[model samples]
Target: SNIDFNPVEDEDSSRILFEIKCHFNLVSEKNNDEYKLENRKLRFVYLSKLNDEVTDDKKLLDEIEKFYDNQGYPEDMNTFIEYMPQDSYTNCKILILRFHEFLNLEGEQLRLI
Candidate 1:
């Protein structure tokens, strides 16, 4: 039987996975009502697409799935977009995610690989 457990092997991929996991943990731990007025708790976390040759949305989604599955998703993972100002007439679209403290089998904030 062929199992598609695509483990994060490449250094770049590994770094990305670690960064994302840390981001989730940070956001979850700092999730408070006062700071959540407009979901400002996750403003500094994101995944960049500007450097990747694989520009397809579907492929990116698959990569995210593989990373999450291999590394394990956080309890209350919430994903969103963070718009960063780059220059005039331009803004960087950063992918941000926050892990919640609910619906977790392991009852953890994050599991980084």
Candidate 2:
């Protein structure tokens, strides 16, 4: 999603200049079988500022790593979070979530929307 900030409002009021993309996976199970299916990946780029007195990059990265590690995925699964500086006037931060592996589930637990 492409977002634009408006100067008319005192509060954070930004406009999305472009389309937004989102991705999620689906799982299904048959009588005695289980399956994992992959879905299209999404990329979201946004501009936001870090909280006050939080300028330590290592601490921020470590926190994100710890959070992903505690998510309890299989050993072979991989997850990563990266932060980089941008040229925007306001303090901006970009977050990327990538799901590379699928989890196994029972058929009854699968809900189709």
Candidate 3:
């Protein structure tokens, strides 16, 4: 025996599936506020590895120079990474500060994990 599917139903389901896929891609591509906050934190850690002292400000200011000397990161991207903090915060303070900074930079934006 042969089975046949309804053309209209198949078309509708296909459209829905396509829409779902597009929505998922959109969510994945855009950096949510939380993700951006996390990125900042990671950036701090990366900077710390480059510095003699692990303070955020010092690391931030010196990262690009270190990277340039080390030839690790592209030179053009240096300016984007050049904000140095005056002092280092404890881990908890760092988290809070990061969250606060994130909120200020991206007010009330929802980010996808």
Candidate 4:
């Protein structure tokens, strides 16, 4: 009797799975508008990561192609990926603003003398 349980043993694959899970959690916590926008933004990151690998998984390959079709990017995905760093910076600023709000620090004076 053989069981068909395929656990991800490869370190890189496991790391990718963990990252995707984390990303999914972050996206799911947002409101509908935020979720849609973040989901599309993060899809670019995944596309860039997967583009570097030589994979034989037809399903994944097909999904990648479908993404290009749906997104209508140029032939080179890197051209679009170049914008991620700035996008990440903007997201960090938003997070910092939220953090300050959570701490009730908005419009407050910090005296460090």
Question: Which regions in candidate 4 have their CA more than 4 angstroms from the true location?
Answer: 1-31, 55-60, 63-113
In candidate 1, stretches whose alpha carbon ends up further than 4 angstroms from where it belongs are: 1-7, 10-51, 76-113
lDDT tens string, model 4, 51-78? 4342444434444545545545434332
Best by TM-score: 1
RMSD of each: 14.6, 15.5, 18.1, 15.9
Ranking by TM-score: 1, 3, 4, 2
Q: Give each model a TM-score.
A: 0.28, 0.22, 0.26, 0.26
Residues 1-113, candidate 1: write the lDDT tens digits.
Answer: 64333334455555654465565554542254433322221221222221133355545445544444443443223241122222234212333112111213212322220
Give me candidate 1's TM-score against the actual structure.
0.28
For model 1 the local lDDT of residue 79 reads 42
Clashing residue pairs, backbone N/CA/C < 3 A, model 4 = none
Candidate 2 local Cα displacement, residue 27, angstroms: 15
Query: For candidate 2, what is the total of clashing residue pairs?
Result: 0
Q: Residues 31-108, candidate 2, lDDT per residue (tens digit)?
A: 212112211111111111211223455554444344334433323223234332324332213332221112121112
Give the alpha-carbon lDDT of every model: 0.34, 0.26, 0.40, 0.41
On lDDT, who's better, 1 or 4?
Answer: 4
